[model samples]
Target: MFLDPLATPGFKRTLFNAIVAPRPIGWISTINAHGQTNLAPFSHFNLVSTAPAVVMFSCNTPADRAEKDTIANVRSTGEFVTNLVTWELREAMNLSSFNAPYGVDEFELAGLEKAPSLKVRPPRVKASPASMECKVLRIIEIEPIVEGDTTSHVVLGRVVGVHLDERLVDAHGHFDTLRAEPLTRLDGDRYAISGRTDMLGRPSPRRD
Candidate 1:
């Protein structure tokens, strides 16, 4: 079937959102300059670079709230932490996603322990297998195509510190992905866990 994005979908935004499937969830935590803590989950997040250990996440304006606490806190203090969610912490992580007030303590609400970060004011999720403390490098506002419509603000942070649970690591100091059993978001309310698979290198060049 052939259809123009503007015509067939009726709403181009919803169509585009669904096409981008199963993005990795970033359970972000941050603290404001005033010492108020905030936690939220974002799917529009990924590692952008490795040289300086950069990660980026986008936070959209909340429907009911005037501003997103994650964005505000990051802008205020220039620091945040990204906690890797595993299958075991899925329910707790989801609780953190609630759109509560700015002063609300998500860690307490979700019943997750807060592990003090080495360099950042925001604490990391102790139950999480891995977490990265980051300092904000940049915050870019994604301008909307039309006026009066504001797009999500993309926050890029440099990972300055890392925390890992020894149980999830091997004796060789390598992260055991299988043992981690990381949880990931699927379409809509669906979710998935990492599966066991064989490693296959790229095919070699064929000889004439």
Candidate 2:
């Protein structure tokens, strides 16, 4: 039930992502220096600031590699887009998570169309109901808990532009969550649809 990650032998580096229960998935899209596109999902992502609209996603460096394509691309281009994953795009979202090679284009890999972003070079997910076009503010690499294991690159960005589905908005301009049906990451192979765990439970489809 309780775990001290630093002291526990053979403790998983990724278990905390599960311990936190369901987490919002940042379906990040980025383009490398050479313009090769990349998309990847990170559960360790959330809005860190409100007024200036900032978000952060922790990208763990693979044990066998120096960094991931997402981290490298973000570092190279200093821009990225966070696409909200919905129930409709769950399969495509899962497909984009495939561990392809460095130059692989996940958009095409997922068989998803791309929409031009307003303020950033990276394209937004056309099928996604919402997308945040962000410019990198900072990237911090944490010290590894297990000494030998390289840690995560915490990439922070300022949301400069937002794309929202007009139909999902209300008279008051509130984006409907239930209508979006966003997907959240859970432990292991599990994933929970948005509005399921947080508002207790709901019958039918009503925004809480």
lDDT of each: 0.85, 0.90
TM-score of each: 0.90, 0.89
Q: Ten-residue segment with the worst summed lDDT in candidate 2?
A: 194-203
Model 1 misplaced regions, further than 4 Å: 146-150, 206-208
Q: State the lDDT of candidate 2 residue by residue for 1-208, as single tens digits.
A: 8778778888885777677978999999999999888999998899998998999999778866789999999889999999999988989999999989889999999999999998999999998999999999999989866566677799999999999999999999999988898898888989988553454555677688
130-203 per-residue lDDT for model 1 (tens digits): 99999999999876665435568999999999899898788899998778877777667777787668999999
RMSD of 1: 2.1
